[model samples]
Target: MRPLSFQAVRSLAAGLAAAALTGGALAAPAAAAPVHAPGPVTEQGGSGQGARLHTNTELARELKRIEHASHGRVRVRSIGTSNQGRPIWYATLGTGPTRLMYVTQQHGNEPLGTESALLALRSLGLGDDRESRALRSKITLGIVVRANPDGHHHGWRYNYDPGADPEYGEPGKGYDINRYHDPAVAPDDNPATEAAVIQRQYAAFRPSIMVDYHMQGRYAFPPPDGREITTSILWPTNDDVSAGALRAAKQVGVRVHDAFTGAGAVVSQYPGGSYEGIARNAYGLRGSASLLVELSALPQERENFQIRSAAISMVDLARAAASGALAGIDPARADAIPPRGPSLPGGSAAAARGAAPAHDAAD
Candidate 1:
């Protein structure tokens, strides 16, 4: 891999500053009803804004469009199919040796990651600026913008399959695609088809860094008057993860946390478990520095803000990784970041009292 030139780093830093300034502009809330059909309908595109998220067809079109517009700078292909036969597309941008794989929307209900990923695709694929070209020279980005199309179509957490897998979350509903990524399970043998698709892709890509994007319930930091955590992040914590891998994952977390927090988004370390089945831990066990990023599910009125926060984080990470800045980040800084506080209460009265809501496991 070629080293990032000093000029490239300066240019990337300048572009990131510009992105931070522009990401906060809000769009009108999407008025159309969220699309539910699995037809070839185009998705309501923009920041989330409680809008209908992108459908499979729309994602395909956008990926092809980016590929075409990039004049060969970007490439798109179908890695595999979902349980419902939806085309699971993978888009690639940049050609450098440092491979970064991002899988978004593993849970059907979480739409922000996919949305932000699209924004990132456009920026990296279409921009002809020095920073974009510079980053492209040092890193190759492999993005699976939507990993669970069946689950996404059903507007649920699990993939939509009536055929029960051993790890099925609810009978007749489907499997939580996120829970079936254990490296011990062969890609072809994985019961959850989406997990199999992702595992196959991971094996083929052999990325140095992999980031899983997800969404979690709303929470505030430090109780009353505390700021809402717009994004929470966690590194692989499985006991089997190597010390080198853990440190690299922490370095990734610290770089990302600093980038987004500087853009005015509140970020905290997520309270995630060390389950080997979870993607974060599984990928780490496979020797990739894995990080899981969970965007907060805020009220509908703030959907755009949340989308912007997550999207720019993606862009920033790409630039940092490409510029070799990520390699230099202090892993120790990750430990200094505050852990996410308790979930906000259900009612305004309860929230005012800082009463904790019913506890649920962090996805």
Candidate 2:
């Protein structure tokens, strides 16, 4: 990548310095995903259950607003179709050397990320900020605004069509898309006709850095206190992630974590070695610095805060990558944020990290 603009470089340098002083503590990831507050291309006035969740129709309307307002700033497209034949849409801006991809609503119930995503797209397309321009110039951003429209429409997690399930539990019970990126095991045989629409985006986009967004019941990575938590992040818990790539992934994760914390959002590290078929390990193995961002529900807070936290973290990390702040990071340090959570006694380390064996998450 070309040298980052002076401002970008300085911003990166300062962040690196802060990281160094903190001994790379920023590498920790947050936890869980949640539902959204819905409306017609508008911001949430509050948090938690108080915010209106977006119905599929509402989301479609919002996407339309983005497409209409983008002008030439973003290229909107239907990457593929869901099992129910709903189109999976994306908004792409920039042609920078590095491609950054963010896929949200992977779990049909997890719509919180959509709020931040819409806000980000609007800012980039309609707003004229120097930072946004610089960041876009350095990174191509591909956003799968909604990875599972079928689920979104029905308020379910699995795609209803036979195409969404190959082998597993019943349709709605066994179609968790996050659990299907093993590459080695295509669960019941991966095929365009069977593999998920989001999987198609993963294959086609081939981003340099990928972040998958989801919301979960509030709880620490190890279910600490069984209480809810905030945004969670995870690097590759498996051996597939290269040392170098892990470092880059950590670099971005750390920056994003700091961004969230700075914004006053609750954040934590997802216990590693736990979730096997996750996008982090899946795409990381395929050569991308990937992360899984989980937002906590249950003790759900205001939706606007959650969404903006996600949006800020994403844009901040993008800028870090574009500015080369993440390119040359010390992978060792990145990897050393120290794994959290206790392993189920006798369970593998992966157990402590909350990872289940491959091919297990149809729920």
Candidate 3:
């Protein structure tokens, strides 16, 4: 399939955004698979060969290893400690002028982002190829893997902060780290500890771009007729976000859409609220070109595929930013992406591919 450019897709925005097309130009996976397909090309190539969802301890060790392997080129440090006393690790690669920040696994269950980011860190720190060297020379990449280590250990959404205020998260279970990134709340005054750590890092780095990675429940336009969505993305939607920053964010979104779609994955505009506390909106309000990428949480059998999809996104976008192509992309093209369709019953990818016809429902 010939990939559509922003100019080509803009013409179909009206119809594409309105309804699920049965037989239009919407691209499907290159192979016979359901909506939760992985990208055809990965940064490291192969089927996510060595990617493993790491434990917090493993993550720390891996970061240190990458740091050592880079021979001081890459820096790894503990930003702060989580509620459970685990180190909230942060790693940086490259010394370039264009700064990029990526955070993954604010929600513990969404593990693919962390896995993919590890793969990306390995490639950036160790690869000696021209692209890797160029990326290192042109862009400084900072990544916070498993930002909410407590929640990740618990295999739940919020961080482990049982004593948090009622408005923090679930009060007893833990605070939802995602909801406490409000720029108005200074790091010292923040309720969620992990969020505060991220804020502190943000203040120090002040990245030009911020990409928050997450995973959504399985979703597709009810099988057979409608294709399953592989990934959904959104630019900062907060009203207070500056126009220029917002446009840059949209250009980033368009770049992401092109990257994933070209890799034979379905891409859509994420249905997100304009909550300033959410990382994407909060970071945008702080003058960064921010974006949220939600890869579909496919079945366990396809875990590697999901990792590859996310790695491709991270690596490709970095390359784009490094090469200066990101600045030339049309922000208006982001509007052409269709709003995400319904979540499959029980949030099952299998159900998404095999379920009977049904009406759209909120995720």
Whole-model lDDT per candidate: 0.73, 0.59, 0.72
Q: lDDT (0-100) at residue 199 of candidate 2?
A: 59
The global Cα lDDT (0 to 1) of model 3 is 0.72
Q: After superposition, how far is residue 352 of candidate 1 from its true place, in Å?
A: 22
Against the true structure, whose lDDT is highest? 1
> Per model, how many backbone clashes are there?
0, 32, 0
TM-score of each prediction: 0.84, 0.73, 0.81
lDDT of 2 by residue, 70-144 (tens): 567777777767665667788888878888999887766567776667656665555446866777788888998
Candidate 2 contains a number of clashing pairs equal to 32
User: Alpha carbon lDDT of residue 150, candidate 1?
Assistant: 74
* Top TM-score prediction, candidate number: 1
TM-score of 2: 0.73
Candidate 2 off by > 4 Å: 1-51, 162-174, 185-195, 220-228, 272-276, 298-301, 328-363
- Give one digit per residue, the lDDT tens place, for model 1 in 112-169: 7776776677667777888678889999999997897777665567787887745537
Give the candidate order by descending lDDT: 1, 3, 2
Error of 1 at 109 (Å): 0.6
